[model samples]
Target: MSRTLLAPRSWPLAVKVPLVVAALMAALGVLASWLVLANLADIQERNLRRLADVTLGTLAASLAAPVERRDIWETFDALDRLTATDSGMPAVAMVVLLPGGEVLAASDPRRFPTLRRLDEPLLRAALRAGDMLFDTSRARAVATYRLEEGGEQLGTLLAELDIGALLAERRRATVALVVSNSFLTLVMAGVGYALVRRMLGPLSRLAVAAERLERGEDPGELLEPPQGSREFRKLFGRFRAMARAVQERETILKRLAEEDRLAQLGRLASAMAHEVNNPLAGLLTVVDTLRRRGEDDGVRRHAVELLERGLLGIRNVVGAMLVAYKEDREAPGLTRRAIDDLRYLVQHEVARKRLELVWTNRLPPVLPVDGGAVRQALLNLLLNACGASPVGGKVVFEAVAEDGVCRFLIADQGPGLPADMAAILERSGPPTTPPGRGLGLWTAATLWQRIGGTIRVERVPGKGTRIRLAVPVRVRAEVV
Candidate 1:
């Protein structure tokens, strides 16, 4: 998870693009600063070497005659003059040695008295020819030169040059480079951020338009065409086209649903007429018998019994239909009777197919769920199963409430359900209506989803298809 969060690919383009640009600029700045500092240091070192050579050569030529004549005053005077000069090199101290390595004269006489052999490590190390050493710890450079008169070595001169000025200049350059590079990096980063934000403006607007479309609102007039690159304009065009198509499709679906509802109502009306007419015919027979044999006690008793049964049958059929079709908001909570009402509701289709139905209900007397929705969903599933079953085939339906959930199962003994139809039950959201097909299954699935239900389908080869629905039990407050 940390890797996922830190991964650059997952970063938003607004941040990622500017950060990359800033990083590249910083790297280039650092490289440029390093190169400039290195080149400056090299030039400064070269100049220092050249100055050292010139200063030492002049000092050595002047000192050679004085040391050969054993003139301490002249040697001291020459050393003093070299230190006093305002040359670029800051000479701190100088010492002249005789041919036998004895100090002839010194700029600091107390430190190196006359005729005393030079014992200082720094001065002794500089006695070799053409050797220039820089002592960074002390911020000084030491140079040595041998005094010669007509191809004869007179003595040696050692000079210690102060280099604080050169070091100070390099420090100033470093500071300037760092400040300028940092400022440049910040400016470039800000510019990069602005450009990226402007480039993504169209995408942000497109996203808003998409959100509006998702909520089933009209996006065509509300969303302006994006004005940016060709790609962004084309994308907005395609999105507008898709939104129109979606709106049209939804309009057609609503129309189709209305038609399907009317068709279902017609079928129910026909079934109810058939059921009521049969009982009415029986009532007619009973009425005729009662009128013809009014004084016969056994005939009157049988007539009354038949009248009661026929009226009761008609009432049950009407009541079941009402329960299945009642508005959900006005319907009572789910109950055993509401679940059982589905049996009567689908009886017409069952009879038409000549199928055997084995129904078992083990629910509590009442449940905290929308009874009308459950009834409607179950009615559709039962009707679908009855239609799928071959003549004389068996369809089974079972319902039970347990563990805070109510489960319903319907199985039919016929050819297995098609894969596409089975997918309607297995999908997560509302089932899409196939063109003029699978409307009943779609309605059942949609109703199930409305009540927070899940569906599972199982197909057995050479047998049939089974669908199970599981709905969680809602609380009383939630049911309302």
Candidate 2:
């Protein structure tokens, strides 16, 4: 399986933004529902209380004359009339009581039997004290009013209001609220998703464009000038400009690198001329000796051996120098043989400059390194060192492998390291110093970095500068 497939997918803004908005809407919806239901309940309770009080007042007035004459039939008829007129109210039953608290009559005789006196504290409070009483568990409300004739108090009328209708209406309202609120929440969720998705549309394109730029490909449509908000358009414009700048810089660097390679080749050509000339002279002399001594087998054999050795030496030098020029060469493991070959190529420079070249090779037989890159790196350093040294000045080149690291040190007896050279070793890329001053150093640094190596420069005021290139030893087999 691909690594990306195995990895968990990250939540995009498209999903996250909508989810956040939906959560907020849902929370607000719940809050609104609670408030609406609470208010509705309060209104229902108030209306129930009001209806009970009005019914009690009407019943008290109707029963006043009937109760004063103590007429049983008339009292029953008055109770019936009270309930009939209160059809719209939630009055379940009505009872007429005398001052002694005995029920004279009831609208529903079966429900509230006669001779049944409701002398409870709540009933008494409603009749003789408080305005009304309510029982929430039973969903009932009670109220009583005094029945009086002239200055004499006859009896009282008590009405029990059934709040079932209010409860039913509350249930219906809640259902309606739930249905309406849910639909609104869904609508809000859909609208929020579309708005958020549209708002973030440019972000995905920007990401793709950035990736394309990183891969050295044209950003194309992904980074096209955006429409809508000024900020978004400006942001995309900046991205396009940045990508163009990076591409331009990359092209310039590639050209500079190619030029540096050609310069190295030019230096190698000079070294090759000096190196090959001496071998050619020796080979020519051997051929002359072979022809003159053709009659003597022993002399001819010796001449032939000398000729072979001289030709081999010349070939070795030429081959060593050509290693750096090989096109698209793969780097091989570091070896003592490779280092010796590099030293051979630079021997001409040492001779031509007449500098005392102190050569030291203490590296292992084999180490993981790109042979071509390492050789080129060494060539740059040796050339730089040679150029810095005056005639008869000493130059030291040493290599040692210790503690699983290869250390190559080059020191030149010159004025000192230049300020630009110091900056080259201190940081990466083209040095801030003037052109032609730090290219070799920069190239050397670049080479070393490719092989996971570091370069350090140490300089004293009067003494010469010493550069140490340290590379961790990786075995060939361990390399990927």
Candidate 3:
């Protein structure tokens, strides 16, 4: 029961609320039934006792003369009149006794064949109406009264009431109580079920909406408008807001992922240009040597061999480029040559924009870093800075290595980061940029983070934006 109540998905609000209400109603019904039955029995017993007192008091008054005069015929005649007057009374037998405690006459001799001596308990217990002794378990009330005339004791009267009619009435009352309580429980259950279902209907719809959102389906109609109380409407509003936020985050992640892929492709192109250009330059040098000194066979043979090797190297570079597009390749560690190659590849873009590219490289050779990927990330940041800079504007590119970490910064002579971008950077989390901004910066941030690094954006002096890219050479432990 506890587990069921705790896991709301298993037992939804629609079912739980009604179950609770039904439980309360059932408890109330049991209590009410107990009280009703008990009170009814008490009332029946009190009414039976009152009837006995009244009937016995009147019979004793009429029997005083007959009992005192010791006339058996008159006493029996009065007993017959008493029974005939009210047949409904539980009066089965009547007897008259003398002051000496001797039974003088009995209305039914068979019921009291041994009534020569009257019962002393019944005689002693006749105090008042409320004090009448009644044996309710046996459905019997024996009332004994001392007959008197002008304060003089005449004789005694003993009446034995049957009490069967009172018992039957009590049984009927019990049946009626059972029927009424059963009806009330059913009514309560129906009303509770209806009210609970009505109250929680909106929540049910909200659950459906949430499930659809989880499945990446639009919750168009489900979140149209909320009904019911103000609290529920407010709750609906909050749910809609939360869902919208999740949707927006998902969109940002998708766009950032695509941008990252595009940035990698761009890197491959740049690296290919650098690789192919070197072999082409070598082939050109070999051709010039052969053209100038073709008379020497040895020189010609050496030049031909060098030319063939350079051409083969270019073929291998092109093949590697095709393979890189088809599958992932091992990442090479950063080196001076790789940095120089990247600088050479981006010179065309910088010259086209006529921007001053302040390239600073301060790092030892053979740094333990993913060269191609880091180059891509750095290239993206540099490209964005150059694009954002005005003509003849300076794009500062700086790189350094220290303490098993690489630090790279790119500052552009353009307006600082946009307001929205600044807000995103101020909130510390995984780097994310909204749509329609610079895809290059978004790609750089994602690539840096994927390699277990952090990216920070700063507003440089003179209305330019400075972006920092940091990557660890190797993971290390830290003391808590």
Candidate 4:
């Protein structure tokens, strides 16, 4: 069995397309923002490291002179001024630790919300250790570290660069991100929505055209186009071409099918006319003979029987052909009267040909379908089976419902199908040659899909070939 997933009829491309695009865009924006945040933090860390190296170098050189306490202050203050005043990026917030771990001088001491002096564990570790550079968060951003000392290892000295400026940088980056993203999102959304809406118009028009075609009108007759797009017009053009090709193929096939039907009807008509003409002539002769010389009861009786049999044959032939050919163009339906009637019709035909008829009562009376089309499909199958049979051949039709689906099985002892016919019917083109048959298996498949059914073909081991059709059931109570 085959399963088909259909899009909901009420779904609107206008709303759906924009929403999907927006979600995708938003995800991209978040990823970009995270990268920017990480990169900005890295740049800030590098700037502070450069400042620490410069401050520590000058302090190390000053260590050669005999220590002057006041000059120590002056040395620290001057160096801080130099870095603070000319920092390409606000590089000022820094603190200097003396030999005894005292806060000798500073740059913006208040920038630190909570200041623990040189006594702090991280600061003490940096000052006590010999000259070294490291990273520590005196603040929520990157801060540089190094020992403040002269080359001659005096008591360890430490200085740390401040990180308050990084917050300002973060704010700036945020503002830029918001402004840039807002502008770009609006521009992209406007362009994307327009593109989507334009693309959708062609599909909508195609649907309308399909409906018109189903009603037996030429869709291309009016040929008004949908709003076109820069990229999608080509797509729609291809779609239109494909639709036209399908319609053309369908038209040709339909003409061929109709011609075949007509030819079959003609054969039946000729047979009936011939049969009726002979019986009428015989009846006329018998009546004339009776009129001339008193009727022979036995001869009259025989003539009457022949006349009745011939008339009955003509009636039966006409009735079958008429039922098979009648078209049902309105809404598809399942009629109780038709199913019961065809079952009997098929039984008689099979009996007349001396073929065995095997049937199972698994088919529910209530199945959603076109009763007439179903009958025609079955009739075609039975006709093929009967014609293919040698005297005393067997044919079987069975139905079973399982897993919320109906399976139809038809088997016959007819000549096993040719490879060519199997390929077209089963569409599993074998590596060998295919058989040619006048009946249209492709049409049967098309009709099956139209009514939400499926067809599969396979060979029955010793019985010849088997055809399987899976159709969905429709209940009358549900329709009511």
Candidate 5:
């Protein structure tokens, strides 16, 4: 359920490509800035060290003669001049000390007085640490140089150089690097986004067109040739061809469906004619018999009974056809009569195959279900069973109402249903029609599904196929 950035396809190419470019640029910028800052800091430190060395060496040379003669005023003057003349060195304080660890002269006399031992712990530690020590915490460098004449140790000169300016310069450089790199990264990221979006514009258009096509709407101007590279043009051409093919196929399928419907209607009409003609012929024969024996009460009574049965048979056939084909705002509920009507609808098929139909109806007088849909579905199933049964074979049709549901079962004495047809019945979705075959079963399955009915099929190896349809009694009527 959770997603990660590593799955780039989840993001659009326009965004993903630009984001990757921006991330890579930012990383490179950070690395470059770090390297440049490091190098800049090194250079600044080297220059500061060089300046400190020169200032210290020159100051030591100037103090050598004065310290040997113990001229405190001249030594203090030399230190003062060193600070006044050199702007780069920024010497904070200077001290002249004797070889015996006694301070001879101090640039700040009140703090480090003449002829007093040096007591600055920081300066003492820096002196003991090395000839030149940088105390970055104090933003200063301390240097100690021995003032010698002819290789004789005359005295020592100590100087503290202020390095705050160098540190500030480095800070400014860092800010500049950061600002420049950020600006460049943003510029490149924006350019990348725009370019990628422009390049993939056709793909976005194609996607929109595809969605429109899927909804069975005309894409029209959406699928028009786009202005871009050759590959996009080719893709658009292929899509147009594909769309044309799809439209053509759909048109053909619609035509085929219309034809199939007409063919089915023709067959039903033929069967109705055959069924009605037989009953009508029998009624005419009975009428002729009654006319010839008008005085015989027995013959008249028998003829009247035959006429009533024949009329009833014709009514059942017509009534079943009307129930199957008629549409109403509110559907009638299922009943025993509707179930029995199916027998009349399929009698023509049963007779054509010379198959014996075993009909059973135990449903209540009325049940809360769409009677039309149920009747039509059962008729289709019974007709299918009759067709599948061989000549002189039995086609069993059973309907029962139990436990708030209506169940209908149809079994054929022929070979078991083909695997594909059985699979269609067993499937929960709308069933697809096999080419020129199994249309009846498909129609039945579709109707059953619309009314929230379930189907179960059992086929025995030595026997035949049994299909059971169960419909909830209280299911809402659905448009079939």
Candidate 6:
């Protein structure tokens, strides 16, 4: 058993292509933005740290000879000059820490709550641990380095670096990205929609062709797309080729069926006509003898009755065989008669084969249908039915108007066939078993279909089989 769902694959290229492109553009946009952001942020921090390190060393250089207050002031004055030269950089505080947690000369001493206290985490770490450290807090990257003179550690240089430009730069970048992405999205939507539509338009044409085939109508030329992309041409080419192949095969089957039907008529034409002519000629002779002898009224009436019935039966046989020659190929002798009259044609043939006849012709037979075709189809079905039937079985013929079309049923007491065989007859395809190079029911079924009609079979279980044939009376002119 299959557990997965089976589905048809259709990309509807218009939708799939645009979505994939949009997703790719978004990914690339994010990736480029991330790279630029990371570099700008790192550069801001690195530049501020370099400036702090240089300023600290110069201030510490003044105290190289002796650690004194005046020396630190001299160092601080020089650091102020340096800060003026690079004024664009934010104001930074550089503090020197003593080993016992006391701060030396520092920038922005008024900003601190206590001048004697070193509260910076980096500064405290430098004083207590006497180790170099780096820490960041409140948009600042701070670092402390131990200042030494001649392999002897003097104090710790604590530096504060401001790097807020990273956020400002990223904000500007994001604005530019929004504008660029908006423009790209518009272009992708417009161009992508056209590209998808162009690629999928051929499939729409193919759908129309399929519809034509389904309604049994002639299909027009499909797209001949050598003017488009290579893949598109190849795909359309295959569709066109398949449509042509199907149409061609259908045409061949129709011709073969017509020929088979005509051929069968040719073989049976002599015997069938002879069968009707003999009874008809004998009845005519008896009527003439009755007239010449000046017989009583009852005797003349009896002979006339036989003559009328025989002539009616003969007219029906000829009517069914109107298309006996090529001259009658597209002609039909359609006339309305009592539907009960059609039943009489098969009644004799049925009784001769020891099969019961059934039908009362309940509806009016003023149907505008080709009576000849109906008679031909009915006669062929009864003959085939008799071959399958046993002695003293029932054969039924019925007529009615259902859903605005005239339908006829011809059933016989014969062995019912398999479902597959019934399907083949319905399709109008050549028999797989070929009906063995002789006259058979498929031949007649094909001929009936060519003129806007159809034959279908239904099983009657214990009784045997029923073949129902229907033709739209509105199409009578086309059939004729």
- Compare the candidates by lDDT and give the number of the best one: 1
The C-alpha stretches of model 3 lying farther than 4 A from their native spots are 1-10, 33-39, 66-77, 84-88, 96-104, 114-130, 133-137, 149-156, 227-234, 260-480
User: Residue-wise lDDT of candidate 5 within 1-480, one digit each (tens)?
Assistant: 247566767888888888898899889999998898889878976777687777778888888899999998999999888777855777899988898878899889998978988898767876677566777778987777778999999988888778888778878988998899888888998999999999988889989988877555688998888775888889999999998987776566556644654676577778988989988988999989988996899999999999999998888888877766676738658778777777767778888888888988898888988887777677777767777788899998888888888888899987888888888788985466678777667767767887889999998754789999999989566643
C-alpha-based local distance difference test score of model 3: 0.71
Sorted by lDDT, highest first, which candidate order results?
A: 1, 5, 2, 3, 6, 4
- What does candidate 4's lDDT look like per residue over 247-349, in tens digits? 7766766676567557655654564466557667876776676676547787667767766776675566556555655664453465444443444445445
**Better candidate number, 4 or 6, judged by TM-score:** 4
The parts of candidate 5 lying over 4 Å away from their true place are 1-9, 65-77, 95-138, 142-158, 263-480
For 52-122, candidate 6 gives per-residue lDDT tens digits of 56666665676555443425565455545655666454546766555555665566666433238766665
* Pairs with backbone N, CA or C atoms under 3 Å apart (clashes), candidate 3: none
| RMSD value for candidate 3 | 12.3
The per-prediction tally of clashing pairs is: 0, 1, 0, 7, 0, 0
Query: What is the lDDT of every predicted structure here?
Result: 0.83, 0.77, 0.71, 0.58, 0.81, 0.63
Candidate with more favorable, higher lDDT: 1 or 3: 1
- TM-score each candidate: 0.71, 0.58, 0.51, 0.60, 0.61, 0.58
Worst 10 residues of 1 by lDDT: 471-480
Supply candidate 2's per-residue lDDT for 465: 83
Candidate 2: where is the Cα deviation over 4 Å?
Answer: 1-11, 60-86, 91-168, 221-223, 226-238, 271-310, 328-480
Lowest-scoring 10 consecutive residues by lDDT in candidate 2? 428-437
The global Cα lDDT (0 to 1) of model 1 is 0.83
| Model 3 lDDT per residue over 289-348, tens place | 878998899999999899888887676656544533433335446775556455544555
